[model samples]
Target: MYILYIFRFFIQKEEGMSCCSFLDLTEADLNLMELNMDRTEFVVQEDGSLISECNDDPNASQRIRVRSDIQERRNTQSMTGTNKVPLHMFSRFGTVRATLLHRVAEGQALVLAANGSFTENNRRALMRILISELIKVHGSCYPPDEAKVALAQAIVTEFPLLRNTRTKKGYEHYYDEETRRGFIEYRLWNVRRTLSPSQKKYKTKALDSGKTTPVSPNINLLSQEELDSKIAWMKCTNPSDSNKQNIATHLQETLQNRRDWIIKKSPNISQILHEYPRLLDYNGEMINNEFRYFFKEKSVNFLARFPSYYCPRILEYAKLNRLDVYNRLKNITDVNLRALFILADLLRINNAMLAQQGDKGKGKMKGKKRQRSSEEAEMIEKEKIDVPSTFLVRFAGTPLPQSIQEASATGSIIIPPYIVCTQEENGRNSYFVQGDGWLIKPRNNNPVTAFDLLFKVYFALKICYPAGLQIFYNFIESYVYDLGTKARGVVTSLHVNLSNLKLDKIASEEFIFGS
Candidate 1:
């Protein structure tokens, strides 16, 4: 089905060398990250499987011990011109772009079904709404230049028949934030048509019709003459009459909001972008948490798209939990609520996908398949793939084992080492730690509310503290609350933590401004 995963551990060593061994004794005096290193032995075959013994020499012992160690690290400050990879490969590497786009596209069916006049301006508005959503979900994946350029191009050309309308002429009048200029319509169409595959079909259709020129979209609800008549009728001879003023005011408001399947004017695509999109926001107003939670529980369409190749949570709880969550969300086929919930759920899932990327080339385990030696004699075929020992741990809002509960309760910093707990076996005590890795626990039980979580998230932004990782810890804490909220309300750890933290006013303003 579907689930979320976060990848923090991957390699115990780089280039067959233990990463922990190079740690100088002074490592203890350094970052909190460097001090915590307990190596775990994971078995890997030549095929990089944790399960298979199939090697060049079947008898050869090649169970590799991999130990991943996090070194003292901080966010490196970047100058104004620091270079990140270009945007073309965004979908290939991360789930952010793909996930966001999928949610935006959810409203396409209803949007296309809109009986409102199919003006070029209207379609452009839809495209702007699409781009706006893309910004919210995957803003960090691409630079502003790419998004702005792509938005301008995509908005204009998504439905090219609208290119010549009077509305289209106004497209360039509004300033775009990224380009620092109004959207230039002409070049965007050329560039987009050049890159898009739909170009071929469009050309063929033009030829099949044997038309001297492209056809114009027939707009029926309102015409230039009708609009001018209406305007004149509103500015009547009874200018001083309150009834006339009221009629004119109502007419203007109606015209501003009216979307007919036949009219031909639109303000700017962005003007109506927020109101129409059903997935993320409704005309700039965010969907209420009530409807969001209601539908998210009822569908998992968002989860099924999770990158299973990297998301261990999808694979780990493939049958038990995550799949069910995804299925539940997906089952909700309502276009409106479903679209919004899917967006929120996808955001949650994609966060896990990004986390998994950090685990690449790290501590991995191999699976083994049985191999048959063939000669003149017939041999039986058998195979087994080695499953990687490295697991993508999901710090979701699920209850933890008793061991984790105890560890979480003592929320204090101490000597960094793998805490070996004593497990009783046949009346004898044996000491062992799971492995060299971190054990994640929720901070409380009421699944962290979006408000509290968002506050913590952007708080660091206002404080100018590097906080790409604030979400990770906040989520863990939220899950803790989710798991425990029902059993213990006030005494739960998350609520206590929430009560203790005093947020300053500047933090609130920064959140408002999104700086």
Candidate 2:
């Protein structure tokens, strides 16, 4: 007896009707079917034979199965079609541009404007179209860095005028590699905000997994009762007192407890200030004390080396490297301006060194493998350095209204601990520690001191170093602070630069002694 096993395959609809097809199962097909047992209903006998039950009316049973499979396929298609954007309709830019022009002009003759720049409305519409097409390929609103870079490159290639010449990479205005804040990122953020709760949860989890957790200090000397009492007293004390001796004493007494609380609880800036009001003291003694607590003797090393050691070496290095910024700032007489320029040059040099290393690695691979390896290396570099979490904003005038305004305009989030250096009307610079919509003016007027405090605050508070300046901060943490010698996450380029600087220092010392 020949037992025919009926299988229904749902094919594409023909003339608005579902088409059901059947295929003869060869031994190979049966093997494939065996691998995918979950998709089909089949019984395996004790002898290891596969069979499907048949009704008395085999033809009727087959017809019912065919109709059910076709209906199921139609339901699946309809559900997915409803969720998907009709990307095929406007995937081609020529078709989209023509359609947009026709609709906007209402079949009238439209002339090109002189500047050829898009208006706000036109830009929004264009971004929407581009994002839709991106989603079609990516299946998510968050496209990878490579995809974003490719899209930005394509845009600039097509429209050369849109290129931003000020940035190193002209396409940075569309998608900046360092800051990760550009037109595309802004649009993606907005899109993510509007996504369904389920989608947002998954995306949020993925993002949170990569975030660097703040490092808390291990010191917790005071008892819970003593800590609570000290916190209560500090909360009631005036932060702007002329004689801050009592407040400073209390702050010193509870330093370890405060750090432990801040690290373990992870309170916001507002809450932290509320508990320890002395953190907002005008002289910045409390802030300095916290730094001393964390680094001890190394706390003074930055101030000692910054002026006498680091500045001179950085300038010498910049000149040797023949950096363009060196020539520009070489003639600057102002101490602060010259120092700032040198720091900027150092960052540029570090970036170049890193890029050169990546390039050398990419040169080893060939053909299709070269392209894949290059992309993977780029992704690895991106992952190794997180996006900038802190910003250094400088402006003319005081920190209260002017510097804060400048920081906000530059898109820097002012949520405590970011450094702000303001040039007052008296030709003097004032360094302020911004804290949750408030400012703490440090007694020091030097920009370099402000940076030292900034780095210490990040360490004491367990904040991540800003990504763009990670190499610079790493050098400071290891060489200056004398901390985290064996810790992971120190970039290899940093060690090479440090070794070179050390050799230069030793050579200079020997020359002076011999002379």
Q: Which stretches of candidate 2 lie over 4 Å from their true place?
A: 1-225, 239-243, 328-337, 348-390, 397-416, 486-515
- Per-residue accuracy of model 2 over 347-390 as CA lDDT, tens digit each: 43244434543445433212111111233234325544222222
Write down the RMSD of candidate 2 (Cα, Å): 22.0
lDDT of 2: 0.51
Each model's TM-score, in the order given?
0.18, 0.43
RMSD of each: 31.6, 22.0
Best by TM-score: 2
lDDT of each residue in 1-515, candidate 1, tens digit only: 11111112234343453223323224334345443233322243344333322234464453443322122110011111243434432222133223234445644542442222232233344444444443332333223444554554443344332232323342222224433454233223333455446433334231121212211345233556665565555445243444544544434333322333112232222222233222122110122222233234422222222221112222222223235445654543322222223223322322332333232311111111111112100100011111010011112233333333443346311111121223255643222211123221112211122222222212211111111222333332233223121211111212222222223322233121111
Count of clashing residue pairs in every prediction = 56, 1
